[model samples]
Target: MRIALSSYRSKPHSGGQGIYVRHLSRELAALGHDVTVFSGPPYPELDDARLVAGRATDRATGPASRQTSSAKRAGATASIEPMSIEPTSIERASVEPPNPGRLRLEKLASLDLYNDDDPFRHPDPRELRDRIDVVEYAGMLSGSFPEPRTFGMRLAREMRSRSREFDVLHDNQTLAPGLLDIARGGLPVVTTIHHPISADRRLEIEAATNPWRKYTKWRWYSFVPMQARVARASSRIITVSETSRDDIVREFGVDPERISIIPVGVDVETFTPDAGVAKNAPGIAVETSAPGVDVETFWPDGSARHRVPGRLTTITSANVPLKGLSVLIDALAFLPQDAWRELVVVGTPNRAVETQLEALGLSPRVRFVSGISDDDLAGLLASAAVHVVPSLYEGFSLPAVEAMACGTPVVATRVGALPQLVHGTDGETSAVTGSAGRVPAAHGGSAGPRAHATGEADTSADADGSDAGILVEPGDAHALAGGIVSLLESEETRTRFGRVGRRRAVTTYSWRAVAEATAAVYTEEIARC
Candidate 1:
């Protein structure tokens, strides 16, 4: 089957979209189908249809053709263990390489106004040669996100004249009217909405202090209504979590039957347990700068048999209010000064975060990293004391799963998919009602945490009622602090959670499983088309 995957922007180092496109395409190709990924600026570093490095005119190519010699295609079952904090791999079951699938990426050009090197960029007048280019610029000037709509237009134009080169069109959340145009030309379109942009808009608007800020937030998310319309019109939709599916039904008014619930996966290959971190010294991990380049990070681990003490890690593609970075900062402030030594954020730090850190005298403790290599990220997760996801909302929290895959326990807000991904105490999660519901602060050298509801396990990864991590009420700084403090204080609890989390991550969320399920969607959609 020939699959054409579309994404407006895929930045592999940071965003989930990039990671989604890269890994899913790879696994799909490994299943012996042909995949051609069409993407705009901040292009994806795909293992499937990958962008050619530093080439003006290199043809897109897939790994199977370049790498596979013989053997039938392997089945998409079992764990995709070890993750690079975001994505990684697992060993494929040795089987015949059926059909020998191929995956390659085709680049799509865009003005790229939001490039970090320069934001709100001024394009050359001559560059605005096409009507589409002018429209993209006009949208940006009006304070609206123009990438999705413009990129869809560009994609439609690219495919307009080409004889149906694909069996199905897989759209990665770029809900645009142009998709309707493509559908008119006889291509089955399958849309994946991680969560609605409306959710983000609501959070930002509510967080805004002034009328002007709220108005700006409204303007920025102006495309959301259009997205909802497109989603309603869409024949088939894919979402990551039950919460997301529910939101789509309530927010977009789309039929529940049109939506399929497929959870996001973690790469077990890049994010595995830290076996190499020698316990020669307490709270020490052999960090690597590159291959054969070792950098050592030492923290005071009193009884932590697994992780560095006071090293908390979190990842966010963007520094938005919805991510709850502010709450995480507040939580840190609530902690005793000696409780935590450092924080490692796996994303860029903006002015807002910097200002908050400075105001709280935490300027010297927090370390922000962007454009980190996969290995480095995995190593960092493995060494960290606790991985935190303090988001007020998440369609699906990828970082939490990735951290779990790295054998790192997570302390996340009890919202979105965190409850499903990270099992709290008592087999299933129960929301916090009041102060009594909050997780109590546990010291760093405490005993085992939570009950072990071990029974006959099911296929749904870590079905045993062992707690993977503690889930706190959303937007509560004190609760966040308590959860983190609890894990930090007890290595026995951390070790248990880490193992259980790993089991859950591996058995439940694997790229191979995701690709196979996605392919099934494509097949069903194409049949309808």
Candidate 2:
């Protein structure tokens, strides 16, 4: 199989794009398929044995120069490497404040400053857009967000000119306007909706206060309509979790039959319990470190509970509001002092969540860990007794999953497919079925007569109370904190839940299984076409 995966920005460290491309391609390559990833800047770091493409260099000497020179050299020898195709690179104007830490050019006339942030500038957007049989372009870029639509337009243009080269086209959530044409063009198309943006949109809107703020929120989510359309047009759709699948059905009106659930898997090898087993817990220092402890374990959210001496605690890998950093901080406020703690949020810092935390008087307890690695993260997760995934919503909740994989119990919101992913230690399930509160009567109205006949009344009453960890109403900080506190204090229950979560993660969530399931879908879609 010759597969082309299209991603606008392939940040290896953050989000699901890197996870999807890296694991899926590795699995496919293992199965003897030729996978060529057609990606934008910060390309995937594929194994050298499987691929040959651009290597990152300084801005003065990037892949484009190397490729052009190599092409000329190859022309001289009349030989070219297979899959040695040059990727598209675009230069645009960067408006970001220059890094003061690094040497800067003082107003050198701003003449043709080569900024690569713009996706359309890359010739490969047009080239691969035309050439690849299947382009899995990422939808969630900074703003221009043209992965689905542009790929469709480019695919349609190429199909018209070349008379069909691909059996099917797969999209990764961009759901651009161009996809409608690709669908109308009679090509088999499938799009993966991790979950609908509607949930995030609604959360962001509710989280906003002023009119201009709400308007800005709307502008950021402007691409959602495109996704809704592409989702409707595609022949089949894939989602990461059953939670998300049901969300799509309710939110996007996509039929459940058309949607398939292929759960995302973590790299167990990279995200295992032992990866950081040797490291001493971060911020905790003893006159003599414990034997077999190598890296520091951080518990920013729950660090106040553990008086691990000398380790600098950090949390909030991405300090965005969606990540529930504010809620974690809120939970911290409920705790007494002398638990001295700090956190390091992983991604670009956002002051809004931090400022809110500060306003609540919990700022001293939290610090953001700006840049870190998966292995370092594994070390942190391994040493910590509790890892919090306070996100209001998540497509797959990678951090929580990775935390569980590392034998650390996770305290995640029972929202957005997370409950389905993480099981309770007591093997108990929450009473709440979906986010729509308690289930109503079968015909309509309250569960009166129907409840009696089916015993739903007793069931509903039983499920009402929090079970395992906690099941709070979505976005309710008080309830979320209560759940975190309950779980954090009960060492016995936490250990039980951690054991169950680890077992579930190891048995059910493996990239090998995910790859097989995904490949089955690819085969089925191609067969249909």
Candidate 3:
């Protein structure tokens, strides 16, 4: 079977979209399917598969290609073309590379010349007047997010012309207007929403201080309109977790029956534990270049586990607000420290969040890293005793799971599908809640942290249950600090949680299992069609 996967931006390090495209395409190809990814700029590198670059597309390409051809005709044998050898034979040369900048333009036109029967190709208008309105462009002009809409429109154009070449169109979260048109055009379409963008929008709205800021955040998320549209049109909707599935149903008003909970799997081949490190350390490492900061710090003892490190060497990624860096910072205040620890966050720092960190008097204890290598990250996680994931909500906490996979204990919030992913035997979980409606905080190091429910019966936070790791109130810095201290102070609990978390992650969240489940959904949908 041949499949075409679509997404707007797919830079490997950008985030989930890149990760999803890379792994899913690999898994699908490994299963003996021919997968061709039709993406825009920063196209994915589908290693080991026949990943044909789609039509070289952009506004300037058409004119650029035409200009290149005209230039070539005027001076045939005088000058050599920079982009490619001017069509070798005079008869074969109709279009020439206009200029280096316009090579993409000619390439778009050259697509059909090289591959005639490749039906999974988008249309390249023959005449300039034949072009149609790009709703995506219009949406962008209106201050609504536009990539998804544009990508969807392009996808629909391809599906209508080349629907016979592919078995189905698998959309990677670009819920665009044309997706429904493609589906209604009789091609089977399936979509995977890693989670909803609406969740981000909601968080941004809450974070906004004024109406103008709120309106701007809302405008930036204008893509939600397209997502909602494509999500409803998809024949089968796949998401990373039950938490996400429920969120989509509630947020998008989609029927629960239409959604399938297929968790995204990690590539264990590239994510195994390193055996060199003995004990992991957490501390702060300040930057000399950063404004208003002096020396780096390290805290070897868990006394101020979340503090800045003077001699400490560690790396963390904290671009995600849900990752709970703020709570971690708050926890730092509870520890006894005088700049003895260093923590290097391997990503962009949220200056706003950083201001709060500085106000906590921890500005000297943190280091921010950008463009870190995978080996460095893996080595860092491998050496660390603990990797903290202070998220308020998570569909499937990858950082926590990845840390465990690297043999490190994770201190994560008891929210979303985290408990299901982290806890085993369900004994510790059920004991806390009992039959009654009240869930008591498990208390200090000896008592274990409490499992306060988040007003949900199924979640680990259920005021009525017990679970692995500490269950704390969402966005509560104090409770978050207490939970981190409970685990940090006890090596036994950390080891126990690490082992159990690794076991669960491997047994349930492996990509092989996820792909098999996802394939089954594709099969079922095709059968229905």
Index of the highest-TM-score prediction: 1
lDDT, candidate 2, 354-379, per-residue tens: 46665776554454443344555555
Q: Report the C-alpha displacement of residue 270, candidate 1, in angstroms.
A: 1.4
Best prediction by lDDT: 1
Writing each residue's lDDT as its tens digit, candidate 1 over 148-228 gives 999889888877975288898999999999898898899999999999989999999998899999999999999999999
The lDDT, on a scale of 0 to 1, for candidate 2 is 0.49
TM-score of candidate 3 to 2 decimals: 0.71
- Could you tell me which 10 consecutive residues in candidate 3 have the lowest summed lDDT? 66-75
Residue-by-residue lDDT tens digits, candidate 3, 177-284: 777888787777888887888887888778788999899889979778667766766778877665677788888877878877776665443334642232244533
Candidate 1: residue 271 lDDT (0-100): 71
True-structure Cα RMSD, model 1: 10.8
Rank all candidate structures by their TM-score, best first, as comma-separated numbers. 1, 3, 2
TM-score comparison, 1 vs 3, better candidate: 1
**490 in model 2: Cα distance from truth in Å?**
3.5
Q: Which stretches of candidate 1 lie over 4 Å from their true place?
A: 48-99, 275-306, 424-464
TM-score of each: 0.80, 0.68, 0.71
